[model samples]
Each structure stands twice: as structure tokens, then as C-alpha cells.
Target: MATLVAGANAALTAENPGLDHVVVGMGWDTIPSNGPQAELVPFALMCDASGEAVSNDHLVFFNQLVSADASMTFVGDGDQEQIDVQLGLVPAEVTKIIFLAYVDPEFRGQGTFASVRSAHIRVATAENRELVRFNLGTDHLDSVTAMIFGELYRHRDDWKFRALGQGYSTGLAGVAKDFGIAL
Candidate 1:
């Protein structure tokens, strides 16, 4: 079962005019189960309207955005860090963001199973604060562990949202398959 943290809340509009699509920024560390450090894995963005994954199969990158391996690489400590991505009307019109995450089976030995202690979704704004935040519970992400859902409205639009529009949810990756929102 999955949870809908926020319905379709408009975050932008024709008047405000947000970019039609977005490329997600992602970075993570790969650590030995018992080692004290972690390494970063590279990441890529997929703009497929059908929700097809963006892997080495479709696009390639020689440097920043692209690499030889299918997944993006992050070289550093295992701790989580934020990465930047470009957003625009390309590949396809992306109104939502999807995060595909799984517990590193090896991580259990180290105590962190690639679990997202917390997660949120927001528009690109003057301040980095999120327009909305979604929480996650065990039930929301049983196998994957957690999922988050965020609605990207046309920029500068007034959307109706509950006070706690943010709640526990399985990240967008989980919901897209069923609801077709991320697509």
C-alpha cells in the first residue's frame, strides 16, 4: 500500500511560468558494511513522459551529466549530500519528481540501510525552503523503506493544501507506476 501525502497542489502557473520539465540532482555514498567511510555514486535524470528510466541505455554523458557507468557516481564520504540538477522543457514535460531509493542490503550491517531519515519536495525559490514537505512511515515504504510525493504547480499559482500537506509517504518513484503523476 502507498500513501498520498499531497494531492495535486498547484505551485506555479502560466502567469508565473515555471519550466515545463526538471532534471533531478542526486548524490549518495557507498560505504563498506563495517567501514567507517562511504563513497559517492553518480546519478542521472530521466525526463521520460512514460516514466521510463534514464539509464546508460538512453542518454550518455562524458562529464558532469553523463558517465561511462549507467548510474551517476559521487566520490566522497558515505554520508548523504545534496546535488544540483537542471530543470527545463526538454526530453519531456516534467511536472513531478521521482526518487528511486532502496535499502543497501549491505548497509544493515553498518546500521543505515540507505534509509531517508526525512525528505521533502519544493519549488526552486529564492530561499531553499520547501513549498511543501512529505513525511514517510513504514507502511508507506515497506520494501523500499520510504517514498515522498510532491506536486509541482505552475510557478506563482495559489494552490489549496492542507496544513499538514506533508506526511509520510513512499517516495515519488513508488507512486508514479500506479498514479502516473510523475509521468
Candidate 2:
């Protein structure tokens, strides 16, 4: 992976001195597939500092994952209960993010299910500065546990998610706290 670098305004060329643009490439491959398009399990995003969604965190999440066909992708917002295309405000200084790929609830029993093999994050500032690039790969069960725990942090505060899985919630909450993003 490339090191995170600052963005430059495209309009601000040697002659223009105004236009700016920043481009980042996030890539991944499923284990043993060696294919270009890897299937990513639905991963959650949260604030590494506060362990909660303030405002800017939402912005960053949308900016990174939002798309027209969002409903069909890993973070698909295709279902109304999930999300559609919508913009929200981002917060001031975001430090870190986490990712996880897992077997969907319906496909959990099947061995052949999509998992988040790898994740990459890139932040482009107003002038298109690439401020952050982070990647994670799941190679063992411990990593999988941590990823699930991260998701627990994301949904812990919600009343609707309260009854999803009592045992898993408790365990995941503890894991999230341990990772510095408690709920």
C-alpha cells in the first residue's frame, strides 16, 4: 500500500495556482481468489477518539462508502432501514478507523461466505490532500473477533439493536472498550 500523502488542488497548478485534486485508490483481494474485485462483508465505521458518532464521523463514512449502488455493495444502503444516498457533516480531527468482513447472518452456516479480506481508508481534504490511508486484513480468528467487537461499539448505544444478540453484545462491548473505542 502507498503511504498516506497530502492532496493538491488541481486548479492550483504552476500556471493556475488555484485548481486542486486528490485521488486515492483502495484495493483488496479475497483470500485464495487472486481476483481484482473482492467481496467485503458489511463493515462499520466509528470515531477512534470518542468512540461515538459526533457529526464529522458520519461525513467521513458517507464520503468513503456512499454510492448510487450503495444498497448492493458491502456497505449497501439499498434497504430503506439501512440507508440511501444522504450527506452528513463530518467532525474536526478523526484519527483512526476499523474494518471487518464476516459471514452474513443468512449465510453464516455456509463455509463459502464473503468476508472482509482487507480494508483501506483514504481521506481527501478540501484541497484534495490525502491525509490518511489505513488497511487491515483478517488472517485469524482473533482478528475476526476484534472486528465483530468494533461493530458492537457501533451499535451499542442504539435501542433497536439492544435485542439482537445479548451474549455477543456484551462480549463485543468489552472488546470495543479494550480497543479504545468503547460504547
Candidate 3:
């Protein structure tokens, strides 16, 4: 599959019914800086049809590696943190699984996005055969503090992958508020 740009999306299960499971991976490279570099922590938000996170436990990251239902599991691999999703096992109330990364607030006090570049997200089969990839564009990275790399959402009985290179200049708090998370 060809690489996707910001806002572009592709059908997942619809293309291959057998593709019921996948590993979504996110990766990035940091730009050298004199000041303390920003700490980037990748996480997944399992949201309901309302677009808000179902609960605090629905937020999966390095700290909370897996969902209670055993549907989404975080797998760390070098610079990339992956989430293995069992599509068929996802809760019925969940409509989307969003992939995001934020600047760890404790690191140099609300760090800027300028510290990272060449960020990307990709989807692959459970066996690691990459299906599609999205390279986040590098425009206006200096001010942003958090970013949404991509998302996998439900469409009827199928799932779709979207490249979302959007960010929050207000820091992680902005993301928490928008998603109704208590930080």
C-alpha cells in the first residue's frame, strides 16, 4: 500500500476479511538540542461512538500496556511502540482506537514538538506484514506539544485507518480536556 498523507485514510478489514488482527506502530526521531529534549510517550485511546474515552483504563500506554478485555496490547520495539489489536475482540461500545503521543510534562516543563521529526504511524498484520504507512508532515512543529499520528475507526462492520498529523499547542492538557480524560 502507498504511504498516506495527513487526513487520508484507507479501508482495513473491508479489503481483506481475513485481516481481523493488526499491529499499529508509531515511530519518530529526535532532533538534537542543547536544552533537555522532550520526552515523547505514545498511547492509545479506545473511544466510544461519542468520541470520548470510555474510561481511564481505556487509555493504554507503556504504563498500562493492555486493555482489560485483552483486545489491545502495547508492544514496545526500539523507537517504535506498537499496539496489537484484536479487531473481533474489541468491545462493542468502542468505535475507534486513536494513536497519540504527548510531551511528558515532567520533562523540561511542557516540552515542544520541535524536538522530534520524521514521525510516522503504520499498520501491519499480526505477523508484521505492513499494510499501510503514514509519514507525519513537518510543518509548524516548533510550537506544538502533542500529536495524533493516526487512528483506526469502525465503519459499519469494517475498520479504517486514518493519518492524522494534528497537534495541540497547549500541551497534553489540551488533549486530556478534549478527550475528557483526567490526565
Candidate 4:
């Protein structure tokens, strides 16, 4: 599998022809600390060409768990969630799907990336064959409350993936506002 850094792009379809489905997985290690550890939650935002959610129900996470067209859904395993997306089945209006993680504000645990040691996001086939991986460097950003790990976007008739590794201090609400998501 190819390892990518922030801003690197991979053409998943070109790399492996006839690939119709993939599992986007994210996992992290947290620093040991007293009291509660940070509760990190993974989510995906299905957006239009303008990079905003096409609708209020276009978010897929632990709460909603699925997208409107059934193109994206979460498969819980271990302490992380694997996202499954049927590329061809995704609505044409949807041009991008951004994968992100946030320290759940509602959770009683520490709500920041200060407790995260290391993290990674990867794409694999339905059979668990990893295609590409991006190891996010979470070093020194103690105030970060939300992070954008990667994204899958439409390139003409094909789909491509990019590593982001961007962080936010305003928490998930800031991310929601920027992406036009209704909470």
C-alpha cells in the first residue's frame, strides 16, 4: 500500500481498476492520563461541488450512522469506525466526502487532541486489502478539538483521495459552520 502525506492525492480507481467499494478506516492512540480520556468520534460529510453538505441529513456518524442515499455508512469495530462508500451509488450531486474526527463535546472525557498521541486514516478494499494510508501527525496541537484527516472527491468521472491533516481549535461547531452542516 502507498503511504501519503498531507496534500498528497491518490487516484483509487486508476490504481486498481474495477474497484467499486472501499472501507475508509481511522484509528488513534491516546495519551494515558488521569480521569477520563478524550472521546474521539469519527464522521463523514457528504458535500456538493461547493464543499457544503447537500442537505441537513448528509452527515454520517455514530449518531446518524448513514447517508441519505445509503452510499455511506459506519461499521463499528474495535474503538474506531470503518466507513463504506459505494462510489457509483453516491448521488451525482455529491462531489466530495470528507472524513473527520472530533473530541465529542458532550462526552465527559477530556475534549481535545491534547490526549491523542498518534493517528492514521486509510483506504482498503472490501476484503481488507489496504490501498493507501496516511499517518496524521498530531504532535504539539494540544488545543485542537477537531481534525480533518482525509477526503474522497470526484475528478470528472473518477474518484480521488487526498490527505488533509488539518486541525481546528473551535471544536466541531466550527467545522460544522465551515462545511454548512446543521449541527
Candidate 2 residues 1-183, lDDT tens each?
133222211211232233232222233444554432223344344344655433322322223464232211233222111222111211223232233333332322322223434444332333435434444434442223223311211122110011111112223344344444324
Query: Scored by Cα lDDT, where does model 2 land?
Result: 0.30
Model 4 error, position 109 (Å):
4.5
lDDT of 3 by residue, 33-134 (tens): 667677898988889988999898888887788888889998758337888999999999999999999888787666777878789999998888788999
Q: Residue 127 lDDT in model 3?
A: 81
Query: Model 1 lDDT vs. the true structure?
Result: 0.32
lDDT of 3: 0.87
Task: State the displacement of the C-alpha of residue 82, model 1, in Å, after optimal TM-score superposition.
Answer: 2.7
Q: lDDT score, residue 113, model 3?
A: 78
Order the numbered candidates by lDDT, best leading.
4, 3, 1, 2
Kindly list the per-residue Cα lDDT of model 4 for residues 50-107, writing each as its tens digit: 8888887888987888888899988857336799998988899999999999998777
Residue runs of model 3 more than 4 Å from their true location after superposition: none
lDDT, candidate 4, equals 0.87
> On lDDT, who's better, 3 or 4?
4
Question: Each model's C-alpha lDDT?
Answer: 0.32, 0.30, 0.87, 0.87
**Candidate 2: minimum summed lDDT over ten consecutive residues — where?**
158-167
Per-prediction TM-score to the true structure, in the order listed: 0.42, 0.33, 0.95, 0.95
Residue pairs in collision within model 3: none
RMSD of 2: 12.3
